[model samples]
Target: MQFDNIRGFLFDLDGVITDTAALHAKAWAGICQRLGIPWTDALAEGTKGVSRMDSLEVILKSVNRQDEFTMAQKAQMATEKNDRYQELITHLTASDILPGMKDFITDLKQHNYQLALASASRNAPTVLKYLGLSDVFPKIVDPSNLTKGKPDPEIYQHAAALLNLEPGQCIGVEDAPAGVASIKAAGAIAVGIGDAHDLAQADVVFPGTASLTLTALRGKLEDGVLNA
Candidate 1:
């Protein structure tokens, strides 16, 4: 399906541009260990594309301890997890950027497409700076002071607004189901980067970043080849 009307692009950070999801999983596991909660890869996957506190709530729910923790306690735990994630992300370099991401971004820039980041990570700025991509995205809609997270659509809507474009004029790229849902809810074309089953709600799904090409994307958009 083509989205020839698309004028801008909104991207989710972790799995889309880099591989920081594992770092987040590790930090969350450490927090679970300290809290004496059972953690697994499945549980870690639940946190993808969500805010720190939201992820904490999911973790607490998994262990049936959500009702037991006071708001203050939950906040403290979230802070602890963020601290750990922050430390781990400090080790990230441009080398951590996913294959084909840099070239794709450069191509988009050369084509004069507006680029914005719509990630749930509050540490997005730090990671972008570490990757030397601080200036690539002129606008970033992060979790700081955000009340609603994906699959809420507020982040993507905000990103489109910041780009001075309507949601329908932007293509939102994500690797998480929640993010795909969010973008679709925002009336934007969702280009998902993950397993087909995981991103069935998206307008189109690609196996990975390396397989996506600017020419193909443009053709899809211009040719109106999208699924209804």
Candidate 2:
């Protein structure tokens, strides 16, 4: 099956476009330690595409310490994580673009599909700026504008709206299950490009974007257009 006539494409950052999830994990764990909170990779992965406040809620709950942290403490902890995340990303260059992503993004633009940044990352602007691809996307909807986070479709829906395209006329590329659910729930095609277990909700799955040549993605884009 192919996704044809896709008027726009939404791409997630972090693990999708940057090899920075590990950095985020490191930062998050560091913040947890300062606050005497336990950290687990599963919690971090589970909350992968959520916003700061939402992620904090998940982490606190995961460690069975949600009730112990006051709102003020949570805010402080979230800020610490953001600061750490920013420090880690401040020096990332365009050389850090994910495998085949630069080529894939170039091919999509060559085909004239609209490109947008639709990520749960509140630091999308900083990260994009650091990567030197800030101008690559015409639309950007970070986590701040949405009341609900991924697995709820708010971010994807916002991106499609920003492009003035029907949800069916847009598609989302993501590496997390929550992100895949967000795209599908928003009525757009979802392409999962990462570990299968992490993207089980996606309509189509690939081992990694390295295997996703332009020809392959364009085929899927064509299908979305046809179906739209």
Candidate 3:
């Protein structure tokens, strides 16, 4: 359970770094309402850590309407959702950063641990800029170039590659189950920042960003609390 070889950190942007997941859900809800589709909690959860088109497919499949839209129409819908999301994120500021996140990131940097972003959101750089964290992540995996999203391990693998490290030499932090799965599948230690029950697959689950600390995480790993 010891992560002595861990030298890099891969982060998810939405729920892990900020509360933008709510904005994403709101935008998706608007899309569902426009399409006459029901927006349930399950549908919202299904979209977490997934790409925009993949999320749209999930929403369409919920009511068996996946085949009703052409690729061009879907593209337009995705663009509309992005527009709504952009509007919502305009209110973001440094205060939007989750508690303890800045300190933890600084701690990581001071320790010489490389950092990169592995977000499914294509607007990650903009979000980081709004949060006054434009320089924190030097390498951000571009979602547009990825052939697969979270739960497929491709994004995390690419993130590790960007850091010039093996997946086993990094820790991936996420707030979604699919993201945790991707990290684990990529052979990295998975750290969850949400409900423990929901992210049971993670190596260690902290309730929130405030609880994420290097000392505490190492303690957990040293104590062999791999699934806690």
Per-residue lDDT tens digits for candidate 1, residues 70-144, read 999999999999899999999999999999999999998998899999999989999999999999986998567
lDDT for each of the candidates? 0.89, 0.82, 0.93
Candidate 1 local lDDT, residue 112: 86
Best by lDDT: 3
Give me the overall lDDT of model 2.
Answer: 0.82
The number of the candidate with the highest TM-score is 3
* TM of each candidate vs. truth: 0.96, 0.92, 0.97
Candidate 2 residues lying further than 4 Å off, grouped into runs, are 220-228
lDDT of 3 by residue, 1-228 (tens): 656888999999988889897899999999999989989999989998899999999999999999998999999999999999999998899999999999899999999999999999999999999999989997999998899888999999999999999999999999999999999999999999989999999999999999999889889988988775
> Whose TM-score is higher: candidate 1's or candidate 2's?
1
Superior by lDDT: candidate 1 or candidate 2? 1
Poorest stretch of ten by lDDT in candidate 2: 219-228
